[model samples]
Target chain A: MNPLLEIRNLSFSYEGSKSLVFEALDLSVREGEFLLVKGPSGSGKSTLLRLICRLNPPLGGTILFQGSDITAIAPARLRRSLCYVAQIPQMIDASVEENLLLPFSFAANSSKSPPSREELRAMLRKFYLEEVEPAQSAMKLSVGQKQRLAIMRALLQDPLLLLLDEPTSALDQESAAMVFSIMERLNIEEGKTLITVTHADYKPVKKRPLNYMLDNRRLNLLP
Target chain B: MNRIIDISLAQLFLALLFILIAQISSFIYHLGLNRDITIGTIRTFAQLFLMGYVLTFILKSSNLWLVLLVFFVMVLSAMFIVKGRVREKQIPYFIPTFLTMLISYFATALFVSGVIVGTAPWWDPRYFLPAGGMVIGNSMSALAIALERLFRDLREQRELVEMKLALGANYREASDELFRKAVSAGMIPSINAMMGVGLVFIPGMMSGQILAGTDPLIAIRYQIVVMLMLVGSTAVTSVVVMLIVRRRCFGSGEEVLLR
Candidate 1:
């Protein structure tokens, strides 16, 4: 089967910087695969994710998502199937219900049926969230709750792929473990693809997942 | 409707009572009986009373030039308010604001008075003055908020926008999120004021006309027209100013000076 995503000869650099961040870098991920990308600071791990998500145009490279070049795709349509959760997700200053329903309100998701209250409750509970107060404001939520809320929001769209940047960076060990377990379950049960960029030891969840390390301007498959 | 007394003295007392309450509340907030409070109160009374007498004369005489002069002065003051409120003083702001006010207010005022209402002179003080004030008021607020929001969003979200462009979103799409947010914030006040007008306070225009002994029905019709004009001018001014400023803020290569 064709890979779900493929990055070919990706090269990028800051506008005025002489040192190129990456050159001739290639990477691919299959459908339903959970790819944990590990890299030290300043190794362009985030940049690779940005390129795949088309958040930043690559200086010289082509990114193929489902056989179509991402650069050539309409943004809202492309982003509809691919949600990127920043390291620090900025939840809008609205009620939790509104924030969760935001993606549904976007023109891209307008046709999709809204998740019923029962489905929302189930999803929240699946992520260990128990509250269902529609008026509970997002600003009052903790960072871990916000992150989980964001994940639940992405999941609501039934996105084909989720690009999470440091999803567990702000959570406690228990919360992080819960997040990993949730991701693991989604990978196995729902066949959802996840590309998570982190500096943490993802080895704990790599037992049944593909792992790669971005080092010295190259992405290499890790043993 | 008959729950209240209908005497003219009673109505005058009621109006005076409300005004007195407003002044006293303001004084209380500023610490009543202080020299600053006393001076402000005197100035407020003097200005309004003087304007009330002057406007009576202006309305009766219907001098077109005098009305135009007042409109011009109001627009100039609005421009200064916009400049003072915005943090970035380096921008040659007078141009955009003046242009925005002129276009938005004149277009709406001329259309409402000349084409719609069919004012004989079209520049009659009775029609032009109030219409001009309403349009200028709305555009003033809209321009101030829109410019501030655009500049602020560019400053704060420069990186996010850059990230979007890097993501292959064009400058328009990359800044699209911020653009929507800025426009929304700019219009929220006007929208809310509109929604809560009668409930929160009888809007100044309608109240002024009612107090001046016009039929309440006529006052309400004018108020309704003023509200529509305000909303229209605000929406137009906001979108236009943003479109104009967006060009200056970003380069052809989709590069933006966010900072």
Candidate 2:
């Protein structure tokens, strides 16, 4: 199958910084592929996801999403298709149900109908947040719950790819395990494409994921 | 209309007695405001006298170009004041903010003087200058507050805004809350003033007119127009400035660019 996303000779550096964060880095993710990138802290792991989402402009090279230059596509459209979940989940000052329904509020997503309450409740259950009341304030959720909720919200958009930054970095071991299980389910059962960047030594029990090490501004496949 | 009584220089000098009381309190309380009081007094006399002479010349000449030139100068000064107040180094907002102020102030002043007041020449120095000056001056402070709040809030809430963007919200949708807040910050003072206008105290313009021996009823009418004019100008100026500055906060990729 043709790659769903491709990166060619990507290079980026922060403004006024002498050193490059990523130099001539290359990556390709095919449909329904689960890829894990492990790196030390500040290894530009988060930057990689951001660059794919076009949150930060790449100084050189190109990002192709579905064989089209991401820059050529409208940013909101690109972002909606390749949704990102930040390391620390951010929730609006509203109910959990409202936060879940936030993406449909955008003009780009206006054509998509919001999930019904029954559907939303099922999603919350599938994400291991079955106890979370829809009407409860999203801000009151624990860090782990928020992360799961963030992933669930992204899924509601029905994105082709999910870019997760440190999906389990802030969770306890049990919570981390729960998140990993969810990731496995998303990839194996739902056949959803995922690119997860983490600094942890995590390996999914049920499926073998293509692993890469990001270090010294290079992404190398780990045999 | 009654004939106005003019105060002689000697009688005006007696007004210094009030300054003397303030100075005495400052000295006794060790407030160290004596220097500020002295400079303020000097500036009050020099600036007001200079403005009086300049107004005399402009009114006597009645040249439309000259009146417009004065209005431009006022707007330029107001822009710099706003620039000094909003301390954002990342975004180059000075030119856009200045242009917003110029357009909004000019349009609002023209409407008030030509359409409402029905000044014969429309650029009549007597009505246009003061009307434009008030619009620029009040909106200047409001713009500063709005810009300050906007840049500060954008920096503080960078993650929140980016979260919205990541969820496919456009720049406008992402920063909608911040935009509303900045506009509100700019408008609250004027709204509060409106609430307190006639009941809390006679406004400065109305008081000045009454002191100039204009009939109280007529003075009240002018004051009402001035008050409403300020509200309209402040709202328009703040909204326009915020709209322009909001675009500067984002990049071509629709990302939050605040450092």
Candidate 3:
């Protein structure tokens, strides 16, 4: 079976920096697979996530998504299929519902109707957030709630691949478990692909999942 | 019509005496502006004197080309000044900046000269050059404000823009909100001036006309027309600049071009 995303000889370095984060690295992610990448700080774990989603363009080599070069795909089309949730989540100044509905307001997602109120409530409930109202201001939410809201917002786009950076770093054990369960449902039942970069411990909800570590600018599978 | 009185050379020198008083006070107070004040006073004298001759020659010539050449020079100088004011030389600002200024100022100048003023030979230097100068000069200042705000916002709100892009937004949708804020800030000064005109302040154009022995009512009418022209030109130029800058802020790949 063909991989959903293929990275060949990828290399990257930030501007004005002498050190290279990675060079001549290769990676592949299968369709509907859940990938958990673990690495200590400054291992380029977050940078790798950014490179996959095209937020930070790769300095060298090519990233192929679904058998097509990402460079050749229209950016709007590419982003709609691959969404990235940053380590420090970004939120709009409006109500939580408005923030969630923002994707549909964009012309790129104009054809995708926004989730209904009941559907949104159900999604919120899945992450153990049962009381977050649509009209409640998003700016006033706690860091944990905001992180879940960002995940929910990413889900609203109905993307084929979800790239999350430190998805559970901001949550406690219980909340982290609930969020992981939601990710499990999305991967197993809904057949969505997920690539999460985090240093936190997670129990697999399905049969043995793949785990990898980035060291010295190379991705190596962990036993 | 009452004949306007011209100040004698002594009276003009009297004006310099006040500037001398300012220079001496600056020296007494240990103010660092002593050099700037002296240089500014000298440059003002030299520039106005040169402009007086240049204006006289341009008006005397009936050739439309000569008049347009002078107008073009004025617009170019204004755009260059704005570029320095914004302090953003890295961005390819010259093309969009110059194009917006030229189109806005010249279009307004033509409408005023051709339709409203109905001057014979619509490109008549006497009527169009001064009007073009005032309109283009004000538009330049307004555009500087908009461009400066845009540069700051693009840096500060980069995360928000990237989030929007990740949410399946096109560049235009992501930048639409900032565009409104920047353009409004640019147009606020002209709007405030319009609101206070005749009530809290008398504008320079009207004052100049009145001092030149024109009837106060006619001067007020001209001032109204000129103010409207300035407001329209500023609005158009500011909008155009923001549109172009917004597009450039995004890369060819539809990602936010974070510098």
Candidate 4:
């Protein structure tokens, strides 16, 4: 089967910088595949995901999402189908429910109805955030809780792929385990494709995930 | 009405006593502001006198093109001042920002002079120049504050903005909160002035008119029009500048590109 996402000869550099972050990089992920890219700090691991999401324009390259050039896609539409969650989860100065419903408020997602209160509460429980009240101020949540809440918020968008950047970096071991377990269920049970970038030693026990190391502007497959 | 009393050069020179008093206070307290005080005093005298001469020439010429040329210069100066104040190195916002300011300032000034004040020729330098200058001057500082707030907030709130973009928000939707805050920052001073006008303090224009021996009631009327014109121009300029600059904050892909 053709890959669900294909990146061909991706290249990027910071403005006015001499060195390239990614030079002639290539990547592909099959449907329902979980990709784990590990690298040291400043290795451009996060930038890889950003490039895929088109948050940072590539110096030269093409990103094909399901065989269509992502550049041809309306940014808002492309983003809706491929949601990205940052390492440091940011919550608006509003209630948790409002934050969760933010994507639906966007015109690109306007066609989809927002999740109902029951559904939102159920999602919170599924994400092990049962204690987080929908009406509670989202900004007041702990970092770990915010991270989980951020994931839950992304899931509400019903994206075709989820790009998570250091999702467990700020969490305690227990919370990290909970996040991993959530990732496991999402991949194995729900068949949601995931591309997570982290420097942590996280591996799912239930299934082996395709792993790569990003170093020196190259992605090398790890045995 | 009695002709307005004119101060001779000697009397004007005596006004330096106020600066002398300030300089002495600076010296006694070791405030280290004597140089700034000196430069400020010099600039005040030189710039005002220069402006007075220019106004006299323009008034005497009474040419519409000349009037517009002065306003153009004022707007251009105001644009550069805003650019200096904003200090954003990454985005090249100069041309768009200048156009926004120029259009809004001219529109506001023309409306005030032509419709509100009812100047005979509408481009009459006597009315148009001051009106245009006031609009540009007030809006210049306001635009600076607004642009500064915008760039700073975009940098500071990069994560939030990116988060919104990642979740399928367009540029406008992603930076909506920051945009509103920036525009508000630009307009708040004008709004506050409105709240305090004719109450806590008489404004500069009103005071000048009163000092020139105009009837207090007529001076109040002009002050009211000037105050309202300022608020309107500030609002329009801030909104327009922010709208244009907000696009600069994002990229063609609708990404937050502040850095």
Strongest candidate by DockQ: 4
lDDT of each: 0.76, 0.93, 0.86, 0.91
Off by over 4 Å in 1: A15-18, A130-136, B1-141, B153-235, B243-259
Error of 4 at B25 (Å): 3.2
lDDT of 1 by residue, B125-179 (tens): 7788778877887777777787888888887887666534433345676677778
Tell me the chain A TM-score of model 2: 0.98
Q: Which ten residues in a row have the lowest lDDT in candidate 2 chain A?
A: A199-208
Better of 1 and 2 by DockQ: 2
Worst 10 residues of 4 chain A by lDDT: A196-205
lDDT-sorted candidate list, best first: 2, 4, 3, 1
Badly placed stretches (over 4 Å) of model 2 are B8-42
lDDT of 2: 0.93
Top candidate when judged by TM-score against the true structure: 4
**Once superposed on the true structure, which residue ranges of model 4 sit more than 4 Å away at CA?**
none
Q: What's the TM-score of chain A alone for every prediction?
A: 0.95, 0.98, 0.95, 0.98
Instruction: Tell me, per candidate, how large a share of the native contacts it keeps.
Output: 0.02, 0.83, 0.69, 0.92
Predicted candidate 3 versus true structure: per-residue lDDT over B1-259, tens digit per residue: 5788898979998899888888899889988888899899889889889889988887777789888888999999898889888888546778887988888899999888877899988998877887898898788889888999887887899889888888778788877888888899899999999999999999998988988888999988889889999999999889888888778877777776657
Write the residue-wise lDDT of candidate 2 on A144-185 in tens digits: 999999999999999999999999999999999999999999
User: Which residue pairs in candidate 2 collide?
Assistant: none
Please give the lDDT score at residue A20 for candidate 2: 97
Candidate 2, B78-135: lDDT as tens digits: 8887888887889989998888888888998898889999999898888888899888
| Model 4 per-residue lDDT at B24 | 100
lDDT of 3 at A28: 93
Write candidate 1's Cα lDDT for A1-223 as tens digits.
Answer: 9998888998898666878888888988889989889888988888777666665666898888999997677766777777777777666678878877777765566788887777777778888888646578988888888888877787778878888888999989887888888888888889899999987665455346778888878799988
Best of the two (1, 2) by lDDT: 2
